[model samples]
Target: MENTNTLTEYLTERQKFVNDEITNLIKQMDAPLQLKDSMLYSMEAGGKRLRPILMMASCESYGGNYKSVMTIAVALEMIHTYSLIHDDLPAMDDDNFRRGKPTNHRKFDEATAILAGDGLLTHSFTVISEDNQLTSDQKVFLIQELANASGPTGMVAGQILDIEGEKVETSLEDLEEIHLLKTGQLIKFAIVSGAYIGGASTHQLESINDFAYYLGLIFQVQDDILDVSGDQELMGKPVGSDENNFKSTYPKLLGLEGAIEQKEKYVQKAKEALKSAGIKNSLLEELTDYLSNRDY
Candidate 1:
């Protein structure tokens, strides 16, 4: 495994690359100035860029050129950004800030924010369809994967479950199901789609899917922990939003200590999945540790 410094550098470089690519793609799109501005506002909001990074990493792991998958990675980020925009709407989380800046709705008008999200979502499909590097079959597969992950069966369903889950005392199992669909589905797509683009075998895709599943749970568990203990400055938002919003969380279902224990278990499971797949990816291994141990 690489040392901490090496891993940090690697992540930083890849994050910069993703950010630059996102900016370039947005500029290339021909849309109304205000709409493009709103989309750019949210897209430029600082984030860890984890999803796209994972996609590129998975592609490289399977000996596929990362550049070949760059369009897909960018589209994933656009979709994710659109979700965040809609998630912060008044009908949703009603968050005022994201990434330490005004949310899309807060930065612009609510209607503009909603439209910006719609624009980004539709533009993502155009991106995939227009990418010259991918064959028609590859494009179709990517579009299908993105649609499945973000549509009714995936993130949208998860969002509905989250909204409904907040109204009642939700069980641990139910909470897991909500997150698995809501948060885990797109994450699963990131890993699996990358592997697909890289031409991974069915067996390899299954293993990576398992690894992503555990990682998604760990990601949310850590978010729960951070909500209770994280610094607002580094977190880029107020802490305890979950409790304030009366949302169900692992730390709420299990005690804080128990939540930490659960995160650790998922971390181990993620690593074991990679091992079982006979894959050797230092970045992915370190990512598990880094995400679980993150302060923000």
Candidate 2:
């Protein structure tokens, strides 16, 4: 209960901070009214705020100011939201429910949704580019980092392989490789990008990246489990969507018991990486456990 409250308080402040700053940025934009509203609508939808929280937490763990990390944290969330908007398209996951509401394509027209996703994607870079607090060197490095993490060599490539996997038989190793790229890459970026922006030592960056790899994989594994067994209100979508879509998953390869075991492997690895970092935050440690054990 104590752990939960601490995590909740930290996250609540971060979410509100990210939301306000991003809202101010959107309001200042000179886009068409409808397009701007559509983008705002998608942004307003509630989410776990996981990526931003991770970014902030990563920075704090490195002795960097969480307030200073907020903009990058918001940028990561925007990038994440953009990916989600596109991924839920009719051609992709076709998801109607996200965070207990209609997916972007359902809330707005498909064209609007696509444009909003594009807007968020490009606007995220604008935030990065226009950030005045970061040194020019830091800004350039972050730009390169964001492009790689969310670009073809990263998240997009993973999505391509995921789509391909759906249409054919995917070996277990191949599926892991695909997910490591698709989902894991951004997660890794979510953590280590903060490290880079914070100027963490190489050893520290390596530890954070190692932690992110397991964190990312464990997150996806938990998603697979939730899609199988979670309630509609909690999950905000139909269960068993993976089976319906024929997406390759840990459960598909390893069966229920085996899959649980596999998730623990990644979870343990994530915790081990955190321990090696020698940080002393109970909340960060418990967050790893929560990620692995959570139902929604």
Candidate 3:
């Protein structure tokens, strides 16, 4: 009960901080009214703010001030939001709803939605590059990291693989590879970027990378579980869309019970990585469990 309360309070405070930072940053942008409005639309559409909060948590765990990493956190969220906007396009998943609200394309026109995504993606780099707190070297490192995570060899490649895999049966290893690129890359950026900003030692960074990798797999596995068994109202989107789209998933490869077991395995792996890293961050450990067990 005490652990639950502490986790709840920690997530609440950090989520509020991320949401406020994102809102303020978007508001300060000098852009067209319609574009700004479109951009803010998805930004305000509610979700867990997982990436930013994870970034901040990782930073705090490494003895760095959360405020120092705020810009990067916000940038990570912007990139994530942009991806969602694009993912909902007619040429993509073609979803009409997000976070219980009209998707960006549904709320606005397709062209506007595309531009909104473009604006957010470009502006994220500006936020990172222009931050005064980070040195130029750090800014370059972050830019490279984000590019590698989201560019052709990373999330985009994973997305292409997913689209292609929908046509045929994909091996479990292949599916894992696809998700590692599509989902895991950005997640890795969130954790590693924080450690980088916090000036972690080489050994600490390696352990943190291991933790992030396993945690990413756990995150995707839980998502697969939710898509099969989650409440639509709480999920803010239709469940079983993976089945509808004929996408390969962990639950499809492994049975539902098997998928749950797989998630637990990765959760344990993540915890072990943290232990090996000698990082005594209870919140980070709790977050891994919370993510695995989340209903939405």
TM for every model, in the order presented, reads 0.96, 0.94, 0.97
Clash list (residue pairs), candidate 2:
none
lDDT tens digits by residue: candidate 3, 209-292: 999999889999999999999999899988998988779999999989999998888998999998876564676788898999
Best by lDDT: 3
lDDT of 3 at 30: 90
Candidate 2, residue 112: how far the Cα is off, in Å: 1.3
What overall lDDT goes with each candidate model? Answer: 0.88, 0.82, 0.89
Superposed model 3: Cα runs more than 4 Å off: 1-5
List per-candidate RMSD values in Å: 1.6, 2.0, 1.7
User: If both were scored by lDDT, which would come out higher, candidate 1 or candidate 3?
Assistant: 3
Candidate 3 residue pairs in backbone clash: none
lDDT (10s digit) by residue, model 2, range 131-250: 888888887877788889889999999999999999988877898789888888878887887666655788888888889888888888888888777787887777887988778888
Clashes of each: 0, 0, 0
TM-score for candidate 2, please give it. Answer: 0.94
Over 4 Å off in model 2, which ranges? 1-5, 278-280
Prediction 2 global C-alpha lDDT: 0.82
User: Which candidate should be chosen as best, given TM-score against the real structure?
Assistant: 3
